[model samples]
Target: MSFKTILAVVTDQAHMSDTLAQAVTMADALDAHLSVVCIGVDRTQTGYYYAGMNAAVLQETMNHAREQAAELATAAKKQMEMSGLRWGVSEAVCQLADMSRYVAAHARFADLAILPRPYGDDRGIELEAATEGALFEGQSPVIVLPEGGAELKMPQKIAVGWNESAEALRAVRSALPFLIAAQSVHIVVIDPPKHGPNRSDPGGQLSQYLARHGVKVEIDVLSKTMPRVSDVMRRHVSDMNADLVVMGAYGHSRFREAILGGATRNMLETSEVPVFMAH
Candidate 1:
């Protein structure tokens, strides 16, 4: 029901500071225990399979990977020490293929996972792997923070994007703690279906459910003027000044989203505010 244990995934040293600061802030706000995991992806796996690979070159490459991981672990320890929150630090040096598995193992024990935005300036294959691992493999709710997102205050106004899918329902349930604590919670349903229960009431059911959980709930049913669902959702977030967005991630198969471009992908690529997501 509450975030008592939080996991922060760090793949590189450059953005580690901002990532940890965001995690620490969330832990401090929720009085949660913070678990930091630094993942060092060994890029030498490709060369290791080469028939003519040199023994010394392989050893040097492996050593470099471990050293990078060690540096991140050291940095995490120092930051966590100064954070003054109940925390722990761990690190791993694994092949790129295994990065997500390592992250998922750590994520399984936490109530929620936080990761740097996997896109933009510092984007990497490792960051994308970490995000997928936490969301799908670990089966946990995740918060993806934008650049300098460490500066965010505890979310007050929240927006929930609803489409009546099972994924949407799960996301709403996972975000219950935040919704209960938020000053305002808007259940935004875009271009709702014309038939069935939604015909008479679109966000009505969800609003009542949240109200029962002590959420100050409202319904914002709007026509879809934009080409994509995410675009409509984004404008609504801006118009309402919502600090956070809670929504289901990858309602379709990952491949489908990649090829067809679903709302989850768009929101991840473009949202400036923090996105709280669950599969």
Candidate 2:
């Protein structure tokens, strides 16, 4: 399936400008509608009526949030128009419920959601909450762009973390559009020495599979002695100058392992490139 609409979740964060630009560019390329959503807290809802904050203070805070939302919406709309994309900007403020859940619910119909990496103070926690809800709860493919990652070209080289699991296969299928556009595609698999499959080599099997699709593909295997699977993947991503990384989200329960699995967790923490992930 191809993406027909791109949803960008924007907030008062460090990479707002860059993220907005990237979202516009992608929307233009895909000829998709760009929806820039800004989420905030609203003090006017009924649930907060009991809190005894002075009337003036509550009014001031609510007014300030509304003003900020308007400013952000205007800036985002200007950028989208400047990019020559057919776009629509939206804003949502919820006082009675969590903003993250609201964003996730809206994200359900979107083809993809682009989010900024969490950074600094309470911002990190907020970003994480939103990202988790959108990724796990929304059931939509999400792209988490690194800070200051506005300049995104069609990726020349794409790397897929392959383990032949169900999640890996799903990730690969979800990324086929990008793969078809990529100049080079590499499948990196880390094999366990002691207890894993023992064949002459399964890497060639995957390469042959891709070759059938008229894609120039290669496979690389790292030794079991490598420091960590994620570390090895990051090293290769740097060496290969890969612009995009595709991987499966290997997590069972939200609270049990919010950022579960080895490769998913490590790349989320250290990779300098954009990651395309799906559960």
The C-alpha lDDT values of all candidates are: 0.88, 0.73
Tens digit of per-residue lDDT, candidate 1, span 54-135: 7887888789888988999999999999988999998888888887788888888889999988867558878888999999
Residue-wise lDDT of candidate 2 within 1-279, one digit each (tens)?
A: 678888888766455688887787777777788788875556464556546777897788777777767777777777777777777888765542466687788678888887776533435455766676676678777777875553665677998888767777777777777777789999887773445573556556667767777667888776655677888888888889899898887544545445444667667767788888888
Candidate 2: stretches off by over 4 Å: 42-62, 95-97, 119-122, 193-200, 203-209, 224-226, 250-252, 256-262
lDDT of 1 at 241: 91
Report the Cα lDDT for candidate 1. 0.88
Native-to-model Cα distance after best TM-score fit, residue 191 in candidate 1, in Å: 1.0
